[model samples]
Target: METAMSDIKIIMKETYSKLVTFKRKENRESFNKELLKVLPQIYRYVSKRLNSAVANGKLNKGMFNPSDFTDQLFIEVYDNIDDIKSENELHVFLFKKVDELLEDSLVEEEFDHVFFDNIDTYSKPEWDAMEENYTQDGDGDFLLLEELDDSSLDKTNYTLNHVFITDEEKKLADKLDASLDKERIYNHIQLVLDKMNLPMRTVFELFTNEGLTTEEIADIRKTTLDQVEELLASARLLLKNSFEKRFLIDSN
Candidate 1:
C-alpha cells in the first residue's frame, strides 16, 4: 500500500511538473493533455454532487451533465493553474474550484439542519422498526440505477471503510461485511449519508470518496483544521452509530 501510494505521489509530481512547464510555454494542448489525466477524479466528484442534488430535489436531472461540470472545471484549471505553487496545491485547487462552481450552480440553502438529535438514544428495535418504513424515491432509484449501469462500479467502494472505526464499530463493520455484499453495503451507506447534514456528508465524502487528508479538506472547504476535524469526527461517529442501529442491533 505504501509503495503504491508512493508511486502515485511520484506520478502526480511528474504530472504537475509537466503542467508547470506547459504553463510556462503557453502550450494549451500539452497542458490539457496533462489535465485530462485527473478527469476521472473530477468526474467522480461531479457525478456524486449532481446525484445528491437530484436526489434532494435541489436540481433537475435533465438540467446538467456531469461532463459539463468537468469541462468547466478544466477551463477553470487551465486559467488558474499558474496560481498553484506545488503539486499539493494543484489537487486542492481543482477541488476548491469544483466546490465554487457547485456553490454557484446549485440553489443556495442552509445545509446545517440537524437530522438526528441523539443517535445513541435510539434502541435497536426502534431502529429496525424505522428501517421498515424507509423507501427510495423514483429519482433516487433512477440515479442509483444509472450508477449501477456504469461499467466501472466504483460507487460500490464508497462506503464507511475510510472512517475511523472503534473496536466496537469494527465489530459492526465486520457484521456488515458478513451479512451484506459490496453493493448492499454501499446502498445502506448511501442512505445513511443522505440523511446526514450537508456539511457532515460533504466532509465525509471528500475524506472517504476523494481520499483527501483532513488538511486538504480544510483547505478545500476554506475552514479551520479544527473545524474540519470536528466535522469528520462527527461524521465518523454518526456512520458507526447508524450501522449499529440499522444493521448490528437485532429487533429479535
Candidate 2:
C-alpha cells in the first residue's frame, strides 16, 4: 500500500507538473516540451497500424487516425493542417484496417502491452488529482455537466451544433452522456470525422462561423430536440473542459 501511495504521489507530481507548465500564458512556447516525449510512441503505433491497413485496402488512403485524435492532436494538426489532415486520414484508414485485423490477430494483446500495461500503474489517486488539478484547475471556473441547467442557454449551444451527425450520432452521444470523459467524446468526434472525411479546418471554420440553436442542430442532424440537447450538453462539457485543460481559467 505504501508503494502504491508513493507511485500515486509520483503520478500526482507528474500530472501537476504538466498542469502547472501548461498554466503559463506562453504555454504554446513550452507546449509539447514534455508531451512530445510520449507522443512518438503513440505516433509509431498509429503509423504501424495504418501501414498494415493500407496494405489490406480495408480503408481509403484518406482516413484520419481515429485512435489518436486527442486535443494534443489538434495542436499538432493546427500548425501544418494539410500534412496533418492527410496523415490523420491515412492513420484512420489504417485504424479501420487494423480493426478488421483484430478479429484474427492478437490485437488485444498488443493493445494490452502498448496501452493497458502501464495503465494499471496509474494510481486512481493520481487520476483524481489530475481531475482535480488538471481539469478543475485549482480555480473554480470548471463546471460539470450536471451543474448546468438543462434549460439554460449559453455559447456552448453553438459549439454543440457544429458536431454534425445523423441518427447514428445519438448512440455515441448517449454513451458520452452516461460518461463525461472528454476522451470518449473526443474519440467519438474523431469517429464522426472519419465518417465525414471532413478536414479539421473545415470543421473548425463551420463551428466558429455560424451560431446554432439547439433546435437548429437537431433539425440538421435529423435527431430529436431532446437528443440534440443531450448532445449539446455533452459538447458544452467538453468545450469548457478543453479550454480549462489547455488554458488557465479566466473567471473574471
Candidate 3:
C-alpha cells in the first residue's frame, strides 16, 4: 500500500538524479539507459493527461501522441533537475508543466463546426427511394393492385413539397447538426478537462486510468483519503458539466 503511494515519486527521484548529473555530450550511454527505463511511466502519465486535455480543446490531435511533449518534459526536467529537490516535487513539477503547456497553447477559439456536408445526405438516393417508393413495404414488396384504394394511395402518395429538401429544412438541419470535426470535438473536450486544477487532474488520472485506488492516490499526492475523494468528486463534476454542454445531454 505504501509502495503504491511512493512508486511514481521513487522512480521520478531516481530518474531525476540521473538527468541532473548528466553532462552535455558525456555519459550518453548511462543517460540512455535511464531514459529507456523511465520513458514508459513518464509517457503514460503525459499521455493520460493529454488525452484528458484534448477532449476539452486544450490540445489538438497532433499532440495526442505525447512523444514530443514527453521530450519537452524531459528537457525541462534536465534543465531544472537540480532545483526539483525531492521525488514528490519532481512528480508534481513534471505533470504540472504538461497541463500548463496545453493551457498556454490556447490562442483562439476554433470556429464552431457548421455542418453543411451532411445536409446533402437528405437528397441522396436512399432518402429519394423512400420518397419514391412510399408504397413499398418493409420487404421491398409493393402494394398489391387488389389492395389498392383511394385511402391507401393517398397515404402512399408523398408529394415533393411534403418531402422536398427545402432551403428552410437545410437550415434546420444545419442548426440540429451538432456535428463538428471529430478532432475539434476532442479538442473542445480536452480544453474543458484542462480546466481542472493540476492536482485534481493528476490524481483523477492516476485513480481512473492507472488503476490506483483513492487511498493510493491520497498517498501519491500526499493528501488525506477524504481530500482525495473530494478532489475526485470536484473533477467529476467539472467534467460532467462540460460533457453535458458538449454532447447536449443533461444530468438534470
Candidate 4:
C-alpha cells in the first residue's frame, strides 16, 4: 500500500512538473492534453451532481450536459492555472470551480432542503414497505455500490457493531449484513442520500465517491474542516441508523 501511494505521488509530481512547463509556454494543446487526464474524475462528479439535481427536480435534464460544465471548467483552468501553486491545489481548484458552477446553475429558489432525521422512529413495516418500493423502482446501480464501497469510511458495509447494538441486534445486523445483497443496500442508501440536504450529500459523495480527503472537501465547499467532518459523520450515522431500522429491527 505504501509503495503504491508513493508511486502515485511520484506520478502526480511528474504531471505537475509537465503542467508547469506547458503553462510557461502557453501551450494550450499540451496543457489541455495533460489536463484531460483529470477530466474523468471531474466528469463523474459533474454527472453525479447533475443526476442528483435532476432527480430532485432542481434542474431540467435537457438544459445542461456534463460536458458543458467540463468545457467551461477547462477554459477556467487554462486562464487560471497560473494562480495554482501546487498539484494538489490545482485538483482542489478544479472541483471548487465546478462546484461554484453547479451552485450558480441550481438557484436557491429551487432547493427544498428536505432531511429525513427520523430514520430511527420509522416502524419496521414502514421500512419494509419502503424497501419493497425501492426494489420495484430499481434505482440503485451496481457501479454506485462499488463507488460507495471504495470510500475510506466504508459506509456500504457498516454493521450494528458501531452503534449501541444489543446482543440480539448484533446478531441481527450480522445476519442482515450477510443476507442483504449489494443492490438492496445500495438502493436504500441512495434513498437515504436523496432525502438529505445538498451539503451533506455533496460532502458524503466528495469523500466517498471522489476519494477526496476532508481537507480537500472543505476547500471545495469553502467550509471549515470541523464542518466537513461533522457533515461526513452525520451522513454516515444517518446511513447506519437507516440501515439498522430497515433491516436489523424486528418487525413485530
Model 1 pairs in collision = none
Per-residue lDDT of candidate 1, residues 99-187 (tens digit): 88887798743442354665556675665444443334311322322322243226565654654367756666776788778766666
User: Which run of 10 residues does model 2 get worst, by summed lDDT?
Assistant: 106-115
Per-model lDDT = 0.68, 0.35, 0.49, 0.67
Instruction: Give the per-residue lDDT of model 2 (tens digit) for 1-252.
Output: 234335423543463355344645446545445433323323333433343333333434445442333324435423432332332232233223333333343222111132222333444454344344422321112222332232221212222234425565555445445545545334333222222211221223222322234454444344577865654554444443332332222331
The per-prediction CA RMSD against the true structure, in angstroms, equals 4.4, 20.2, 21.1, 5.8
Candidate 3 residue-wise lDDT, 1-252, digit = tens: 244336645676787677656634457556655654555545555555554444445555564355656567656666666687765566656555655664565343332223212222333344335323322211112222232222211221111111114575444334323554434333333343344556766666666444456776666566799999897777655544443333432221
Q: What is residue 247's positional error in candidate 2, in angstroms?
A: 54
TM-score of 3: 0.42
Candidate 4 per-residue C-alpha lDDT over 77-110 given as tens digits, one digit per residue, 9 for 90 to 100: 8888778888788777888999998888874423
How many backbone clashes are present in model 4?
A: 0
Candidate 3 has its poorest 10 consecutive residues by lDDT at 155-164
Q: What is candidate 1's TM-score against the reference?
A: 0.80
**Deviating ranges (above 4 Å) for candidate 3:** 1-6, 23-29, 53-60, 106-203, 206-231, 236-252
TM-score of each: 0.80, 0.22, 0.42, 0.74
What ranking emerges by TM-score with the best candidate at the front? 1, 4, 3, 2
lDDT: the better of candidates 1 and 3: 1
